[model samples]
Target: MVDQDIFDRLLQFRPSGAPVLSVYVGVDGGPSALRTKLESLVGEVLEQAEAEPSQALRRSLLSDVARVLDLAARGGPPEGSTVGIFACHRAGLYEEVVVPRRARDRAVVDATPYLRPLLAFLDESRRYCLVVLDRMQACLYELFMGELEGATIVVTPGKPGRPVGRDPSPAHRLFRETADVADEFIHATRAELLLVGGPEETVAAFLPFVPHHLRGRVAGTFAFDPRTMGPEQARCCAEAVVDRYERAEEASLVAEILDRVTTGGLGAAGIPWCLAAVNEEAVQFLLIDEEARASGSACDACGWLGLVGATCQRCGGPLRVTQDVIEEMGAAVIGASGRVEHVQAPTPLSQHSVAAFLRFDVPHSAAQVVG
Candidate 1:
């Protein structure tokens, strides 16, 4: 999974002397199939670039390709549905990141690593903290991108000589300490949500002890015993809650976007308006149906994107066809630090396939209407 520091590093990576190579393959058909797919996709890209006149580029590409093949052969294929391999041997940079989501199968030989697909996944993915509470102990775990880790324990805070914060009972003291630890983890990981687990009566009593700010982030609670439930079992518990929470959030967000579109607020629906919003850097939040697809054109010179255009609206440059411009638009929004979410279909956004909450109203001139 991609973290902020790693994402920032990838974003800032500069090639030493040769262009970078990035390949992403989904782990659908198991390890053997994953190996075959990686070889096929990367081979195709390398074959196309074989005739490039630059010796340095060829040597670097080949070296990185060798590294990838070696890793696939020796180290086991990554866990999860998608794996991203970024290599720039000349620059001494190589990274393999696996994510819980699925992405397109494509390889790019570019000046920097390709990151749009990963960025899109990260936009929908949120870090979660799970706290299983007990009267004298609280077990905290961090959940992200389908992985659960760090089963750290926070016990009642009355140190031998130190004065722990005054509390009415052992349960209250444990809850307070647990809240403090949860708050720290949330702040550290930038966790957008949280879930609590434990006895029913205990949880009912503990909710009030959570800080006001954290109370809002606590999506729900589960019942479990920290001693009996292992990490994997607890992960299953948290995953279910996170899944339900996100589905509900997506529905609510789509509804808001639809309402905003109708009321002339800061929102847009359908391909053309969303394309325009992204191109103009006015999208604050972008939402799209996962299965939606649209063919669009993009400007080569100025990088302006739209649903259909014979000539670039911004720079009058020649336009090129893109098979799926929704992906492009999502990448563009990410480039501008805007959030993009791929919502499951059957929601209100199914008809439009695309929507956005704008950062500011797009002017008439910048609006690229459908032809």
Candidate 2:
């Protein structure tokens, strides 16, 4: 898991005179295979850097890359599909991060670090917490992007006998105790969504005891016998709940955007309109279909993005054609500190593939309907 504080610290690092080496290498499969592959990759990166203009800077950069190699050789890769290494001797910045998602091998030497991929992956993975509880035993599971971190049994004391009017029942008191334990774990994990599963009656009893804030964030409940359930079964149930919740949220966002487009309010649909909104820094939230693609052009000089053009209309500069303009638009939105949502398949945004809620309205004329 990438530590939020550490990530923020890395982002705060200032650029120095020398170039920073940002390397991301895949480390999936066997550890031995990864180790062998990583050595060759590191050698290739260093060999290329040696031919750079600045001899003195290249030597210093090589030393830093050597340090990264040493660290990897000693510790091997952390438990993840990919690892990110950022090193700069001049800036005195050196860090390695294990990312859950897969990343292609990339080596870049730039004044500032290349962090777009990591940031995008983090944005895509919203953390969730799963609590499986029954009468005798309870467990809490922390999930990141549908992958289970670990699970542990929760311990709580049994409640006293039931009371009459205005007094809590024994079952209520017991559930409240379980909720307290679960609450502490949830806070520590910083889970965005909470899902509860167990025998039906226990889940019913526990739901009312959950704190109001957490209760609001509950995705949904499912049925699972904690005593009989294994890790795989628990993971499947939690993932299903999250999938359903995310799908519903996506549907709601698409519906809201459609309504806003019709009313000429805070939303815009289609690639051109969303691109315009992104350029204007007007997007509050960007909605894009998961498998949607829009091949378009962007101006390097003026940073103008459009669906079509041989040359930039705003600037006379030449245009650079891209495979997917939506990706560029997403990067722009993230650069402006706006949120992004990649809606799953079978969404209402299927036709347009791109949509956004703006910080302020752009007139309907700005949007162009594209096939």
The prediction achieving the highest TM-score against the true structure is 1
Q: Tell me each candidate's TM-score.
A: 0.76, 0.68
Cα lDDT listed for each candidate: 0.78, 0.75
Backbone clashes, each candidate: 0, 0
Between which residue pairs do clashes occur in model 1? none
**After superposing candidate 1, which stretches have Cα over 4 Å from the reference?**
3-23, 26-33, 36-71, 74-77, 86-96, 100-117, 156-168, 363-370
**Ten-residue region with minimum lDDT total, candidate 2:** 159-168
Q: Residues 1-371, candidate 2: write the lDDT tens digits.
A: 78877677665554465777878877766656666666777776677677878887887788777876665457666555678888888677888887865777777666556565566567658877888888666778888864788786654444445343453355555577677767887889888888899998889878988998788989999999977887779888887887788889889989999898888788999887788777778999998887787778767676677888788777777776655677667766766789888787477799888889999987656655221
- Candidate 1 local lDDT, 151-267, one digit each (tens): 879787533454455555767777877787788899988888889988778889889988998888998898878777777778888888877888788899999999988988888
Per-model root-mean-square deviation over C-alphas: 5.0, 5.8
